[model samples]
Target: MTPTAASERTHLVFDRALVRRRLARAAWLGAEPFLLERAAEDMADRLAAVKRRFETAVDLGTPTDAVARALAGHAAVGHLMRAAPLAAGAPDVVADEEALPFAPGTLDLVVSALSLQMANDLPGVLAQVRRTLRPDGLFLAALLGGSSLTELRQAFAIAESETTGGISPRVAPFADVRDLGALLQRAGFALPVTDVDRVVVRYSSPFTLFSDLRRMGAANALAERRRVPLRRATLLRAAEVYAERFADPDGKVRATFEIVFLSGWAPHESQQKPLRPGSARMRLAEALGAKEVPLPPSGDERD
Candidate 1:
């Protein structure tokens, strides 16, 4: 889609009330506590691995105390800051990734944990991130990706098709690894890497999974949408469809969480440059001793 079209669609898809309700439910579901602890652990591990390389770091979309915990052991304490607001105890400074307040090339490192999936314009946000990094600066992020919540998507699709005769866009679409890598390249990030980690959790019923998602502040956030209450019959039918299609033989439904980890670097003049043309370039066809395939000339290039 064109940028304008995408922006309009994103505005229509994001529902603030749905997000608030999901956050409230997620807090009640103890997702905040669990996520905070996880973030702390991950940050500590990440810091230990890259402390010698980086002198400054920013945690984008860090919504809990994890960023603080991650920076606690780093010598760059003064440079550590968060970019999202949280509860009173959480470490945050209320920032958005799309329009970071930091000056260009000011950051040495940027980390995001389980964030960025909510961004309306992920590529634009990545560009902003790229602009904030110094040459050779590192960018690391984790976000929910495709293959996540397959059971939920299937269940919702079945329910809507059978009940409403149409499917509503409930869950936000996530980027696959390939698409995410391309986006990083498009944003001018160097040596971009993308990896997926699949986490499967079992639930006794579909309701249990739904409840967990709500507690995690993950729900439908589409704006300009109807808010009709789900009927009992529809709910039961959804549950049945979920169990029959997504359940294991043990009767528990499996929910897949595909976490995508990405890392890249800011371009630098000192970095290795591409080889000059006509210099020894490795051609796959030549290496394989295969005949070169002729391409159809464009209208402009035709003889």
Candidate 2:
């Protein structure tokens, strides 16, 4: 499985320092963390579906600490440790998104909500998660993904190109569902699975959506981002374009937020494995009640 163009830029484009600073500011604002709350709710549903219990668990960089609250009453979780990036709020642990500090096979479970999308080395991050998990340990996570913020990206690109004669990278790219699943399996995790949940939130205007993104610490923090602030003309023009194109009957603009959830487990002897391809007792043609036709012709002979 190949990573999308967006995924390819993680190491080259995202400014890690800028992302941390934005998240720190977002935490200080202490506004309504609707996105985190929603992600937390979905993670809880996933956690509930698992039949086994975890003796030790961690919440990795959940901005509003919503996941901790979600797991508070969960019987499967015996202990909960909350952590954030080095620049973010206080937590039981201070971990870098790129390199987690856990010893091998120490964690029984790890769950993250609305984080991991910004990781510079996503493959390395997945590897670290797999290494930390004990055999049969589970990792459940959610992050922004496919078609997220299409309207905003388009508006910004159009405005900048029109007003400034060039466009700057305004939005960080997110991983698609298939890429995430591939990364999980590549990280040595077993039973990897991924899916998405689309959340379309309406706002009075695109500016209001921008405000909420500010509160969520979701800012354009690309390393290659334009150093100069967006010109007032560009900002206003972008708003105009956004309203014209995305506004609904009520004059509210639409913002698409796609959350991708990934589930994987550390490899273990007890987990089910696929049988060998040729080991099937039934023949493919016989199983399908079809006659097999035999034909042999080399390319040279045919030509």
Candidate 3:
């Protein structure tokens, strides 16, 4: 039977097959995955301040298992498990970020490092996470933010537009800080908080950034991306544009990797509650030592 043409043309955003393939290749290169390690350290620090013990914890998407390692000897953590992409260093479990196989209310803590930005159905995945957590369970994660790879994205966009007469999704887009906070609430997480950690790394050249991204499994995997490989001229022009516009005084280019950290909790009755409207006994004037001015007369009130 002849193979269908449509199957060959169709591609999915953050294509799982392609991601696994690229990651497998990257594993052979022996490059350190620094981003994952750094984000894992941030999670460990944040967890230390929470002052709560989690008997059962899972570290998701941290391919290097850095979070798991950080949590292992900590007093607050009784056990630690790991889930990573199939091609990555052998995790305790292999799973997709979008689809987890945990039972509802089974977990006490869930943390992810330097992942989730690539999820096609992030809101849905978050909703699933909310359902998976036990009461008062914590969910902490750091994801690449909208500001990440701005230089690379811009250079690729301009180069593609100029050379190919159109621009495709050359670099993946990340979620905004506000949007992620709202998404947590929408996913039924209580007391959601979001903060940004902007990391500006100096690279000798754009190709160095590209090489790092390859090892980090942070490549463009957009569904609408052009099938044809980036033209040599386009790649060279992109490098030129990046160096010209984003280079520092020392000729090293600045590459920003903004990691947005999100923290939320499964709701419990003991958590803080907001006061209802008109519930305060003291007037605004009494509290602030200011007088309330009378409202201006409406047209109907005039004689």
Candidate with top TM-score is 3
lDDT of each residue in 120-169, candidate 3, tens digit only: 67877788788889999999999999999998989988887888788888
Could you arrange the candidates by TM-score from highest to lowest? 3, 2, 1
Candidate 2 residue lDDT tens string, 26-58: 777764578778888888888888898999998
Report every candidate's CA lDDT.
Answer: 0.74, 0.85, 0.83
Q: Write the per-residue lDDT of candidate 1 for residues 202-244, one digit (tens) a residue.
A: 8999988777776667767766444776667777888899899
Cα error of candidate 2 at position 87, Å: 4.8
What RMSD, rounded to one decimal, does every model reach?
Answer: 5.2, 4.2, 4.8
RMSD of candidate 2 to the truth, in angstroms, is 4.2
Shift in Å, residue 194, candidate 2 = 0.7
Off by over 4 Å in 2: 1-10, 285-303
Candidate achieving higher lDDT, 1 or 2? 2
> Which 10 consecutive residues of model 2 have the lowest summed lDDT?
1-10
Summing lDDT over every window of 10 consecutive residues in candidate 1, give the lowest-scoring window: 84-93
Where is model 3 poorest over a 10-residue stretch in terms of lDDT? Answer: 1-10
